[model samples]
Target: MTCLPKCAVLELTYQCNHKCKFCSCPWYAPNSSYSIGQELNLNQWKQVILKLYDLGIQAFSISGGECLLKDCLPDILRFINEEGQTRGLRKEIVVISNGLLMNDDYLQLFKQNHVHLSMSLPGIETFAQHTGVDNANGVLHWFQEAKRIGLNTTVNITVTKKNYYELFRTISLGLINGASSVLLNRFLPGGRGLIYQDELALNKAQLNCMLDTAEEVLILSNRYGFVGTEIPLCAIDSPEKHKHLRYGTKCAAAKDFFVIDPAGQIRTCNHSPKVVGNIFHQEIIEDKEYWNIFANSNYHPTICQSCKLLNMCDCGCREVANILHHSPSAVDDSTELYVARPAKP
Candidate 1:
């Protein structure tokens, strides 16, 4: 468990331009995300990246309320790109943005640095309903433009009751237009998503439909992609059927990757509000005890302890469980929503 993770997400800033109803930035929630001007500046952020690189973390994801809102972003990207070049290392850098601020310069920078870019597309026809803007076309256009300039792109989709039916079409539009791959996250209520939970949440039947649609599209398109969030293995209807989708099972928090907020606080994952420690103030290895919780997390949804798929699933995101019931030992909300085990594959 003392071994470092492979990727680190640096949330550059909480400032954003979009007002999507499903915004997951911690600031939009009941608790304040950070002090108004407490976010690390360009030099401090540079220090963070250097510290991470020294810790042997080679991949980084630059994200935000909207990353483009950070004036230091271009500098941060340039710094990472230049550092990798100077070190003769091919560090992986990914930027996930809302796409309202994407432009040619950013695309070209991503192309030159080999930074993979992902754009969040909530839905096609109902995109305006979620983001308060009818710019889904513009997102697709950004994909086309990214392709034209030779940058790798991904369409990041967050599925909820609001966009459940349009899931497949959204994938098709992105892939056909120019997205090289897709990343889907079935909504986990947190931050702003918490307030609108009832209106945006997806149930078991609807969740299955979305997965079914996603599986078909990936196979038919023959593209490379995977789901970005964890789901219960038992809830998955067919083990063989969903195996190819490569979404998530069990939990990868603090294992495969971790998140660092704008104020330099380490979180178990992006959705997790828990801060393990700050990288600048202390050595990350000093906080191995905090990561132990995730490494040795309890079986969520007590029933998962006896399920045949116990080894393969941890009863979905514990973060969701914590958010809903506010107890570390509580079961995931999906446990109640999905009553029966998915009839074994």
Candidate 2:
């Protein structure tokens, strides 16, 4: 509870090109009066990275509405890559993008810096439906190019009601196109996703089917890796069944990770809208007190208090719980929609 974070998510900009229905950027609200309009410039980003490095955070994940949309992204990447080289630090850099803006230069920077890149691809057939773009094929081609260049390639598939059925095809396509891994992300009904939950959120049966498909894919394929993020442990088969699968029983929030928004405000996690403090305004960087307080939090639903899998599931994502239940620690009783506890328990 008193340690530094191993990784930090830095939102370089709130500006994005695509208008995906499930876009979860916390600051993005189309009709809202307030938004995260202020963004840190390239130099400010460099300073923040240096401050994080000084605080012993070795790994960083950079994102944006679309990180590649930033004109100075190459400069930012160059700064981070050059600093990593000069400091001789065991730096782990990752970039998450929609893959629409991916180019040879971006690929070159990734290859030059050992950066791991994950492109968001709901499904090739349904890309336009999900991302409001018809360039799925083009993005896949870019992924192949990135793979050919020896960069770590991954695809992020957000499983929603619209794309749940095509989950396997999406994963298969990504693997066939030279992706080393595919991440099946759960749809958190926060930020923009909150507004589209009725149309996008997966019900219990769909969620199970998605997990089942993912498990089967993992078992059959040995070369490709599949990870389900923010999935309830109870929704999937045992961890022993899949070697590459990763799921969190509890929310990482301020525990294992923290997200820095575009304006330098630090949230417990990317999905969490709760602002703990700003990394620059507060002494959060130098000390672990801010994270420690939230790390030790124990509030939970009454139903979870006696469940056998309580520790294993942590009642799923607290951010989603907060959106539905009005408290991060409360349960939505939507187990019928996702998971269920034993009758006797």
Candidate 3:
């Protein structure tokens, strides 16, 4: 049986604490302005979640400019947990945050609900450079606290040109700080990321170097897991992982992982502009054709159709192609252009 995505990402809020240069928020810009429009209330978000549950999605991830900022967050988590339990669905909840606002009370809620936690780590000294926050180390402490409380923690490092050189170090520090796994994400041009795309984007060579290090980290951190999302599969150190990566590492959009923005808009994923429907509209939710649009759209490029590695990489990321060519369906192998850099021990 083919493994399909069974997750949904809910952008709880567009408001954030850090002014990361590479942030992918649609309305965010460096310090000039933030959170442009009204966001869906807690009730509205619940409706979205309920619809997703009906769709047979078992995994839900809550994110935001900083998801922890919402005062109703604990209630939100509890509601989802309770609803999933009542329905007898084995739901997996994930919370993504910068970790600065995390505390004992929130940790308790997460622990009680069995939520997996992931914190953003920009890099060592480059945290300030990437996040535009001085107290970067403070954010790192949240992961430790999460681990202390027995919550499964994963460290997310958004790989950009500014922090590409420090990728390995960031992964090491994350593991040392008690993170159970590390997810290295390729930087995409969106939100504030578009502001400095040229400067922040990683070249193919640099990404390959990062992947090489990813393989080494997997070997070194035997107990910990490593995944480089949105990176080319050809760049991976092990051909052995390619088959599994084909299904596991593909864009969630290509599968069925839906996204609900703070505004209640349903998208295939954050990177794609195509809005399948709005959760606030019951008619839209009930209409199968609206969702079929997302399911029908083929993200794979024609260039990718003939390759044996087709499933492994899927021609990089569609959202990236959307940004580079102004068409989500266009083909772009930007990863192939970068000159490979040497991997560090």
Candidate 4:
């Protein structure tokens, strides 16, 4: 476990059924140049789980445009469970999905296998606007059912300008529906997100507003959660105030985990198009240089290196840096306008 990644995100496929405007998938971009890659077969996927477990990966996050689109997921989960049981290792599995396809049968199967579900929510009435899906109400119903069925479910809200004002109300509804915890994410420009950046991206003022709303809502709900996106310490007026709010705080990409796409290529993280290497070819557990690429070596500057908050902050999304500045290590835009701006009282 010392040299290995503690978690590995295994993307089942790139094909998703929803036209979520904020989707970062490159192929989802309008007039996009990228196309879907070939997915790992059931047998190949079983091999992936086996190798990942051997590499001491403690958790496997199953995701895709929509993972349920894959016919072999149940079998793949069975493989993961069987592998964990056989090796007597503490293996964790969480499925990141839109929750549209999760039927009762799938729910029972997930519960039986000890799977955690991170379902995307579009905020109270902003669902149709954000997801381009009309069944927003159904998403909440399924979330409540999952929690009732005894699944550790997380309500994932991707904050955009449209849903920004509804942040608190959204978290409240999710909590009322029995969400075990809540996760907040700010829209980062990339892939399809680039096409919608002007429409969805939040500004510094909005980011501060979100932090205030999130902190207040979490305190009121008394739920266990955090804003799951990497935000720079300098972006917030007082980063210390959010300690109780539980910000994602630091970038955990290569430090804690790495992402593997459908073609077996490893990315710095899911939003990053920079493929580190194929899981079949890379020495993930032993390669320190590979790990260094995501440690913000290129993004951090002299000022950042000298800052006290440097260790706890990654400046912001490395993918955002790479996308906007063409340098993965470039200073985060969040910290560019001001160095430690003040938040509203």
Candidate 1 vs. true structure, TM-score:
0.92
Question: Candidate 1: worst 10 consecutive residues by lDDT?
Answer: 334-343
Q: What's the lDDT for candidate 3? A: 0.70
**Which structure among the candidates has the greatest TM-score?**
1
Residue pairs with backbone atoms closer than 3 Å in model 2 (clashes): 204-337
Cα-based RMSD of candidate 2:
2.9
- Compared with the true structure, what per-residue lDDT tens digits does model 3 show for residues 1-345? 112258878888878888888787766634533334478777876777787677677878899869998877887888889989989976669899988787888888899987999888988889888887776577667778878878888888888778878877888888888888777777777667778888887776776666666666666766445454565454555546432112134655736676777787766676655555666665554434434433655666665566576655555666667656866556654445322222332
- Candidate number achieving the greatest lDDT relative to the actual structure: 1
> lDDT by residue for model 2 over 76-168, one digit each (tens)?
777877877778875658899988877898899888877899888887777898788888887789889988988887888888888988888
- Per-residue lDDT value at 234 in model 3: 48
Local distance difference test scores for all models: 0.80, 0.73, 0.70, 0.77
Model 3, residue pairs in steric clash: none
Write the residue-wise lDDT of candidate 4 on 219-327 in tens digits: 8877556887878776776566665477775777876878888878777678776665666765643444545766534456445666776666667787677767777
lDDT tens digits, residue span 138-174, model 1: 9999999998988888999988898989898999999
Report how far off residue 35 is in candidate 1 (Å).
6.2
Ranking under TM-score, best-scoring first?
1, 4, 2, 3
Query: With candidate 4 superimposed using the best TM-score fit, by how many Å does residue 237's alpha carbon deviate from the native?
Result: 2.4
TM-scores, all models, native as reference = 0.92, 0.90, 0.85, 0.90
